[model samples]
Target: MPDYSLLARQLKALLDTRDWLTNSAQTSAFLMQEIPDLNWAGFYLQRSSEQLTLGPFQGKPACNPIPFSKGVCGAAARTRQTQRIDDVHAVADHIACDSASESELVVPILDTNGALWGVLDLDSPRKARFSEADQAGIEALVEIFCQASDLD
Candidate 1:
């Protein structure tokens, strides 16, 4: 079991630095290495007009751009909440960028004023990869992203 509290704290510290982009990139790399049984760990950012463009990510090449209502990342951004799918195959609108991925966790990153900004997306090659505890942990990390100073 990953120590989510420590992970969240580490993420918060990383997000607090002046270089957010560099930090976010590093964070993605760190998560990709730290988290277990994960095929992907990265971010998708929404910059203008509700468009979610691919950001720093670590894994197999993912879909270039995802709509706000399309995949798990899109749904999380559209709903401004977390989306955890045990089986990607069972998800009606699941986007299979990596056919090996069996599970996914999407955490929406909010701005300071509680507005949708982007999402932290993680995909696992193993089934039932994310649990409620994982959700809670990642949500804490996203909350840190919301309150952190580095988002632009």
Candidate 2:
């Protein structure tokens, strides 16, 4: 029973006057604190032509650069869609940067032109930590982040 409206407002306000890169860091911090049962919360950005570079994140250090066609982050970037994994063990090509993470959710952040820019990734130690409601709420937050922050 998370207050999505309040969360969205906070994210929007934080990003309204901040650069995307800077604001993304703030957003990750916010989510890491707000969300319960999460072991990791962060952003993975498309730095080069076909690479997903690690961005500001909360939790342990993660894999530096994830390829565009590998792992959950890559699948989200390649498909430009949200990836909700209830069980990380079941996901093929799963990256075990953190052995304690049992579940993961990845939401792709798109620019106004619908270009793949980055992704917001969340990991939980509990299996099936994310629900449909969580997905919708996070997706809404992503939209707000896109609208408020400068993609350039």
For each candidate in the order shown, give its overall lDDT on alpha carbons: 0.83, 0.89
lDDT agreement of model 2 with the native = 0.89
Model 1 TM-score is 0.90
Itemize residue pairs with steric clashes in candidate 1.
none
Q: Which candidate achieves the best TM-score against the true structure?
A: 2
Model 2 residue 100 lDDT score: 99
TM-score of each: 0.90, 0.95
Distance from true position, residue 38, model 2, in Å? Answer: 0.8
Clashing pairs in 2: none
Q: By summed lDDT, which 10 consecutive residues of candidate 2 come out lowest?
A: 10-19
